[model samples]
Target: MKNVSTREPGLHKGVLYAMLAAALFGASTPFAKVFVGQVAPVSLAGVLYLGSGVGLLACFLVRALVQRGQVGQPVALTKPDLPWLAGAIAAGGVAGPVLLMVGLSMMPASSASLLLNMEGVLTAMLAWFVCKENFDRRIFIGMLLIVAAGALLSWEQVPVLGVPWGAFAILGACLCWAIDNNLTRKVSASDPLQIAMVKGLVAGIVNIAIALAFGYALPGAGTALAAGAVGFCGYGLSLVMFVLALRHLGTARTGAYFSAAPFVGAAISLIMLAEAPGATFWIAAALMGGGIWLHLTESHGHEHEHEAMEHLHAHSHDGHHQHEHDFEWDGSEPHAHPHQHVPQRHAHPHYPDIHHRHRH
Candidate 1:
C-alpha cells in the first residue's frame, strides 16, 4: 500500500483547495442572482459558462505551448476518454449552471441557496453507488441528515405552481454534477488542467448555442461584466481547485467538503440580498456544520496510524546466539549462527544496538 503520510500532505492541500473552491462557488450564487434579475437567465448562463470555458481553454493552450519542447510530450486525450469528457461537459458545464441560473431567477435566494445543498447528497450517493466507493453507516446517516435539513430549511419556500419543473431542473442539475464527478474520476490520471479545459470549451459552445436558441436576451454592460467575473471565479477557478482536490481527496471526501458551499452561499445571500433567514435555516446550518465536522474528524484514524508508523522501527536478532548468526543448527555445541540480517523501515527511529530473531 502507498504510505498514508506521503498521501496526507497532498490530502491536506486538497482540503484547503476544496474549501476555497466551495467558498468561491458559494459566492457565485448571490452574484448570479444579481445578474438573473436584470438579464435573461439563458443568456447570462451562456455567457458565464462560455467565458469560464474560454478562460480554462486559454490556460490549457498556453501550458501546452510552453511544454511543447519539454522532455515528455504533452498529455494526449484518447478516444476512450472522450465519452467521459463529454459527459462532464454536458452535466457540469452545460446542464448544472443553466438549471442553477434558471432556478435562481425563479426562486428566492434563500430558498435557492438551501436547495443547492442537495447537490452534495446527490453527489455522495452517486459516487458511492456508481463509482463503487466505500460509504459507511455514519456517512449514510450524515447524508440523510443533510437531506432532511435541506427539506426543512426550504419547506415553506417551495412554490405551488410551475415549481415542480423548476425543482426537477434543479435536481437534474445535481444529477449532472454527480455524473460529472464520477466521470472526471475515471479520467483523473490525466492532467487536471487539460481535462478541465476540454470540458469547459465543449460545454461552453453547447450552452451558448442552447441559450441563443431559447431566445435569451443579452444583458447590458454592467451585468455582462458581473456575469463574467462570477463565471471566472466560480466556474473557472472553482473547477481548477476541485480537480486538484479530487487528485488527493477522491470524489466522496471532495463531495463531503463541498457540501459547505450551499450554506456559504446562503450566508452570502443573506448579507448581499438583505434576506432574513428563519429559525429553520439556523437549525439546518447547525446540522450541516455537524456533518462537516464528522466528515473531517473521520480522517483522524488514518492520520494516527501514519504518525505511529513514522516513529517506530522493527529489527531481528537472535537471543540464543552470542555472536552473529549465519545459519540454523539443531542443539549442537558451538552451534553455527545461520543468518545475520538487518532491516530498516523508513521514517522511524533506528535502533543500532538491538538484534533479535525474526518473528513470524
Candidate 2:
C-alpha cells in the first residue's frame, strides 16, 4: 500500500517554488514576444538561452568566489548525473525549440500559440503515467482547469486537430519538453544552479552553432540583449525554481502547478499592453484560480511501507534521514552526501515527493 502525506514542510516549499517559477516564466512571455520579428526565431532562442547561461554562470561564479576556501560545501552533479542532464538539455533545449520554430513557420500564429499549450498537458501525462507520480481526482481536475485556461487565452478557433505536419512538429516539441522535464527530475536533488547552468549553456551553444551552420545571422546587439534578458528570467530562473519544485513536489504535481503559467502570462500581457480583456479572459482566470486553489488545498494520506533504499542528494536531519557517518561528521545542515534508508512503515499525509515514491 502507498500512503500520501501533505503535512511535510517540503510540499509547502515546493508550492512556493512552483508558483514563483510560473510567475517568472509567465512574465517572460510578453517580453519574449517583443523579440519575435526583430530576430530570427531559432537564432533568438539561442541568444535567450545563452543569456540565461551567462547570467546564472556569473551568479554561480560570484557565489563560489565569496565562499572561497570554504570546505565541506556540497559538490553537485556526480558522474551518474551526466546522462540525465545531457538528455534533458538535448531534448528540451535543442530539439524542443527547433521543432517549435519549424512548426510555427508552417502554421498560423493562432494555431501555434494554442499548440504550445500542449506542453503542460504532455508534461502532466508523462509525469503521471511514465514517471508514476501520484495524483488524486482533485489534482487531476486542477490540472485540467489550468490547461483549459491556457487554451482559452490562446483560443482563436484553431482547429483542434485539422493541421497536418505542422501540428505534428509542434506536438513533437511538447513531447520533447515533457521528456526533458521528467529526466531533469532524475537529477533534481543536485544543486539547481549547477543543473540549470549546465543545461542552459549546452543547449544554447548547440542551438546557436546549428543556426550559424545554416547561415542564420545574429540579431543586432540591442535585440540580442533583450532576448537574453528575457531568457534569463523565462528559461533560466524558471528552470531553477522548477527543479527545486521537483525536489519537493515530484513531477506531475509540479507540472500541474506550472500549468497556471499561461493564465499569469495572459494577465501580465493585459496589464502591460493596457488592453481590456474579454469575458473569456476573466472566465479563464476564475477557472485557473479555482484549479490552483484545489491543488493548494489538497491533502493526500494513506498507510504505506518504505523499502530500504540508498542515494545521494542535499538534505537536512529530518525524520526521514537519521543515519550516522563513516568518516568525520559536521553539524552543517542541508548538506549533500551518499546515504541509506532502512525499511520502515508509517501512515501520514503526503505527496509523491522524492522520499515517498511508493507504488500504489
Candidate number of the best TM-score: 2
Cα RMSD (Å) between model 2 and the true structure? 2.3
The lDDT values for all models are 0.63, 0.86
Minimal lDDT window, size 10, model 1: 349-358
Residue range 161-196, candidate 2, lDDT tens digits:
555889999999999999999999999988898898
How far residue 215's Cα lies from its native spot in candidate 2, in Å, is: 1.8
Q: After superposition, how far is residue 10 of candidate 2 from its true place, in Å?
A: 11
Model 2: which ten-residue window has the lowest total lDDT?
1-10
C-alpha-based local distance difference test score of model 1: 0.63
Predictions: Cα RMSD each: 13.0, 2.3
- Candidate achieving the largest lDDT: 2
Candidate 2: lDDT over CA atoms?
Answer: 0.86
